[model samples]
Target chain A: MKKMLLLYVVVIGTLMAYLYMVYFREDNGGLSENAGLHGKTDERYVMVNFLTGIDYWKNSLKGFEDAAEALGVSVEYRGSTQYDVQEEVMVLEQVIARSPSGIAVSAINSEALNAAINKAVEAGIPVVMFDSDAPDSDAYSFLGTNNYNAGVTAAREMAELTGGQGEVGIISLPNQLNHQERTRGFSDTLAKEFPKLRLVGIEDGKGDQLVTEQKSLELMERYPGLTGIFVTEANGGVGAGNAVLQAEKIDKVHIISFDTDKGTLDMVKSGTISATLAQGTWNMGYWSLMHLFHLHNELAEPMPDWRSSDVPPLPTYVDTGITVVTESNVDQFYAK
Target chain B: MKKMLLLYVVVIGTLMAYLYMVYFREDNGGLSENAGLHGKTDERYVMVNFLTGIDYWKNSLKGFEDAAEALGVSVEYRGSTQYDVQEEVMVLEQVIARSPSGIAVSAINSEALNAAINKAVEAGIPVVMFDSDAPDSDAYSFLGTNNYNAGVTAAREMAELTGGQGEVGIISLPNQLNHQERTRGFSDTLAKEFPKLRLVGIEDGKGDQLVTEQKSLELMERYPGLTGIFVTEANGGVGAGNAVLQAEKIDKVHIISFDTDKGTLDMVKSGTISATLAQGTWNMGYWSLMHLFHLHNELAEPMPDWRSSDVPPLPTYVDTGITVVTESNVDQFYAK
Candidate 1:
């Protein structure tokens, strides 16, 4: 009778454990580390970009990190740290192999990264794009400024600065998708909205201040009557401003630049640059990770008709927005 | 007899425990965390800097982290994200309250931070300075480029760029200790060596690009024969470059800028600016941490001379060197 009692106890214990295991087993899509002590997780996310050390990405990275800190998770910063796209792809592939909980990428070339991004998605990793985007990729969402609208805003500001009737030029990096869109938006808006403002020339600044200066000078020499120059990036903005100063056209030529880096802000304050567009850089970084965290955790919850491809409860595109920074408010944009 | 035996056993056990505790107690200057499991020390080091988000600190911080990874310790980066000295002091005070194993600081002002730095040292924390220094403070060692020598090099490079005979000026942040040293070096060298090259003017750029440009333009206008300008900082360098470019003097004026930031390097490669000085920034950060780890851990050793002030055996000043980046080798300086 004592032996029988022992057997019953053993059977009951085994049954209890089996039931608990069955009931508590949650789908993780075969990823995610085992839950830590006290049912906590130590999942890590990553933010990727090219030219990672530039001031351009500082605010965005801070937002990504702040979100991670609030959620009790960890985030790592990784990137090409150069302008090269191949390096970005290689870094992405290596990161995917590590199977991070999520990835936020700023694509150097829009279409070149689709395959690598798709591979990460296929492996059940959540991916989001920020700052720059690969629109066709399997990224769950895109979080950044509406580049075209920002360009239109720049055009309107330029028109005001130049009184809408003058020859203007664009100093841009022609190959970048964002710059391409910005150039199109500026030219299109200028042609449509302000018919008298002529875009006499477009030159590639190559996103280098000196190159922008050289190109701006060439544009000026090419069209001596050029009364305005729109630099599609920060470095180019400063370069164009310099070119204007060199040509002794600081008063005659009005410059509209993008981004509120120290260089551009200084130019704007000094009236070398008439205006600059400040992107909601922090919003892009913060919300991308926030969305990724929710998407990553959603797999552990059950809902009818929940599909891997259909990540619900979050918008796929978030326009983080931008603001026009002039001398009047340039003080607000200084690093704090 | 039984009571006596029990008493003897208790006495021996207590003696053994006392001996172990006394012998194994390591001197950490009363600052380091308790040793971790299996004879490991979970020491944490911190690097404090100003303008925390700028690209200038990125390489140095990477070096600090790399050393920590190799040594199985952790490092934290904290600093004033803005160029504010009070903010830096506040951050340092907060870090001191944590009683980290070690601290590394880059002072924004040479004298304003002495009291705070000395307080950290007095609290038994190992403090080292990198990139910049508080020469009057209680920092154990300073690991950075010799600012005066770097300046002298810039002067020589500027002289060479201008073919030895031309009017040149300086755009510098005169209030900064390092910038002041650089300006002195450039001016002294020009007076002593480049007899034909006249130092026409020295206007404060305030380390802002636009300010530098304005100052540079004034220098040029004040001295139309100005064939070269020595910019003591990177932002100012580019600003001065822009001024020369805007003055339509790209070919006529030679710019000797400091640092290998992308802006300066790009200008160097495109021949917009003449050259830049690349500080051994990585070395400054890596060695500062490595030394701090040693200083913090040495008190635990049986070294008789190890004391709070003695700091024991490491050189107090480490000359982290600099390299000249011209068009011939500008490719080496691009982000890897």
Candidate 2:
């Protein structure tokens, strides 16, 4: 009977101890020592974009890596070497096959990448679009600059440079989503805000410097009163700046450009371009990874049928924001 | 010897069991059973806004409550009884005194509430500005519709309604941050985007229907060719609509306005107002809380000296976004 009593005490004590540990955790409100602000290092995420080697993607990549570090997770960067939509789509499929924890993409072609994005999401992998978006896709959210708003900023800047009274023209890649939105925003703002200023022409730069230069020359020749030009891309900005300089119309025509590439920044510094618009590229990368991490962990709920719902657990869109860089702020934009 | 051997077995077994549990939790990447998508119910948050009794605050308040529920945290709604800046500042100070986990504020005046906001931050309370912002304050984030962008949307809609050609005017409260941004956005867009549309006049509405009506009538009389009106506030929208209707120019003069207030909705439904821009007020509340939660838990790290840092953990500004409500979508705006 004494031996039986000893066994009972031992069993009961162990059971109570285990229960106490669990109860303590529950009482502490889910903040058990094991639960922290960190994730598993093995949990991996991937960021995919087109024109993989460009400096424009550097800030965004840094943001992604920073988020990975914060979350204690691993990340990989993969993209097409050039501006080929098919190649980007293929790369996305390859990444999906490897089945990372989540994927963040900057779609090269908005519609063309929908199938692959949808496939990944349907297979239970969370996906988000950053920098550039394929809006119609099943990707959960978009984190990027609102291209239209960016254009409005450019137009307002152009108006300021020309004293709100001058004829301005646009040189842009008319086929690109970002460029189109910028053109519309610039044209719309110019028409509604500065009645004294007129949009004299809109010519497609075809994302080529030579083409933009020729288009700029044609516009200048066609509209002698054109006192300003807005280019929707970096190459076009440089091209247009060159055209203005070669034609001796640099000072006479104020040029507002996009991006802060070395060439574009040089023009802004040299007084060839009045100013340029810089996007929140880094924010795009950081927020995209955060969103993916949340969705993957089931920490976010999409507000069931969010299409009809008033509010989603995650924002449908996040305008990362924009900045106006001119000669005064141009030095900071240059690569170290 | 037998008794001693039995005691050693029990002791060693319990130790191994405890060690195994701890090791398992760590190996699973801190996702212990106690860890979840929730916080302690005692972790409370507060949301403060001016004009607390108005219907405008209802949706935002609901969003705050919803987020609190999701996070298993307690929340309280507090604000000033009227659109009084000093009163709002007092209310914010009171909330700060209680030392809630966080506070979200919609400032009544852009600059008047800065001191109160700064005090909250200095006291170590995470404060976020929602709907309206004090840009220079130490608040960590501003989660709301970009008023300037909303104005731009209004301008674009007005141009479409008036066939991109007409004389337009604005009715707004000049001193309000939101109204000022809307007016600037509208005027800038009109002057830059719609070359054919002329903004003839801008009048202060004082947020009173009668004053707005008087201003609208004066504008119509001043510009005999006026074809559009963009009111920056709901009362002004309704007042402007009434003036156009009474003047027998409802059909001749298209009106684009702000908000989804019943008055604005009724005008849109009855065709007195062509359309109204609805802000993402709900998003403002939801995101503000989420940001606060992250900051309170130290899950986010705002880059040291974020003012000079290229990237901060939190976005400086979030354009919650806007929706254009027309006759077809007017019914949805009515409170159920």
Q: Score the docking of each candidate (DockQ).
A: 0.01, 0.13
Q: What's model 2's lDDT at A163?
A: 91
How many clashing residue pairs are found in candidate 2? 24
Highest-scoring model, lDDT:
2
User: For all the candidates, what are their Cα RMSDs to the real structure?
Assistant: 26.3, 8.0
Residue-level lDDT tens digits of model 2 in B47-79:
999989999887777777766766667799999
Off by over 4 Å in 2: A9-46, A51-77, A82-86, A92-103, A107-129, A132-282, A290-304, A308-336, B1-42, B217-226, B244-250, B301-311
Candidate 1: which stretches are off by over 4 Å?
A: A1-336, B1-41, B299-305, B308-312
Candidate 2, B27: how far from true, in Å? 6.7
| Number of clashing pairs per prediction, in order | 2, 24
